[model samples]
Target: MMPDRSDLSAIAALLREVAGSIVMPRFGHIGPADLRTKSGPLDPVTVADEAAERALTEGLRALFPDVAVIGEESVAADPALLGAVAGPAPVFVIDPIDGTQNYAAGLPLFGLMIALVEGNQTIAGLIHDPLRDDTMLATRGAGAFLLRGAAARAEFLPLRVAAPAPLAQMIASVSWQYMAADEKSRVLARLDAIGQTPNLRCAAATYRAMASGHMHATVSRRTLPWDHAAGTLIVEEAGGHVRRPDGEAWRPADIDGGLIAAADRDTWHRLRDALYG
Candidate 1:
């Protein structure tokens, strides 16, 4: 069943609470860490990730008994298992720790991402910065908002893409994915036109930067549903566009590792034209 606007709001509140409980206990306590790699050397996961994911999974099941969930940890065990909840039916996509690297490094930029995919498209999203207890939320057709603290007032905000800015003055964010030699050279060449290329290691932070208009745009060569889901909507809700290099529309069920997001429509087109040519 499709959740109404009120339902999404309630879910966001629950998600925020879950993230706070699981993540706050270990904040600023960088002692006796328990971290491990997932796919490669730099792809790290910690106890906090698992604990937070478990909490989210359990809470969602309790709240929406009929809904399906696909979590980062579960997908890691059997990547093929993701198909079980990828589309059509109501599904909850989660990245318990969107910026695992930042979290491991003791940075407060890390966050929790939760997105509800209804039939292939993301209809609602909520991102929580557990360290700061800040929440960015959005529902399709409805506006987005930022909520601070437990009892803070919700600020209703509209997302509108800015007009085209000069490419030389634009700020672009890209990930250092393990690209092949040819891909690396091509990406660098594309970025050369922009004068200065900025790279941020964490997706959630990068998305936040772009949404807040500090960064003009952001693109990632490698991303899963959880990586882009919540942030993509937040950016779009904050007046941005999220798409692919070939001008292809992004679908939530896509796990083939391509993600592009920009602060405004024009910036997105500029980057797309530059990179694809």
Candidate 2:
């Protein structure tokens, strides 16, 4: 069954606790010894990421003993853990720190993301900003909301995507880091059609911006489940549009083929055509 408001609160509380204890404490204090390269120099995994993931995993298991937990750090050690997302049972996907590069550099732009996936579809999602102590959450069919302050005294504000705008007036976050050389060049050339294309290096923040109407869209060439699953659901719930570059719905099991999220379907189509057509 999908989580209700009470369950969402519990999960949010867990994220807050872990962020306060494990993530924020090490935000600007990371040392060379506390960090290590993952796929490459551009991909980093810090002590905070590992520690927070452990706490999150433990907390989630405690909350739902039967649900499988697939954390970025844990999956790095055991790639098979990712298979849980495609399984028949429910699974929780966690990204302890979404922008390790920024966090390691003392920039407070990272976030903690978690998504509950069942039957290969995301049923709920949460993105918590540790510094702001606010969370953007969404459960399928219930709409999206932003919760602030402690759980007991939390205030939930409804979230919505920006009103539709012309392609030339839209601002977007475009990630070209993993794109093929030829494809990257082609997309970059077409980006001039948009008003602005900034790279925040944090998917959580980008999704938040799009959901809250601060930005119009985002285009990502890499679609890792931990990175996009939660954010995509949040945006869609907030009345945005999301799909792979080919115009098919994005699923938790999709690892690549690019993804586009926009304020609406018309914007998505325009952006897709500008970038690929």
Error of 2 at 112 (Å): 0.4
lDDT of 2 by residue, 1-277 (tens): 5999889989999999999999998888999999999889988999999999999999999999988899888988999888888888999999999999999999989999999999889999999999899999999999999989885799889999999888888998999989999999999899889998889999999999999999999999888899999999999999999999999998998887889999999999999999999
User: lDDT of candidate 1?
Assistant: 0.75
Please, what is the TM-score per model?
A: 0.90, 0.98
Which regions of candidate 1 are displaced past 4 Å? 30-33, 149-153, 159-163
Model-by-model lDDT, in order? Answer: 0.75, 0.93
Q: In angstroms, how far off is 55's CA in candidate 1?
A: 0.4
What C-alpha lDDT, on a 0 to 100 scale, does residue 42 get in candidate 2?
89
Give residue 224's error in model 1 in angstroms. 0.4
What lDDT score is found at residue 158 in candidate 1? 49
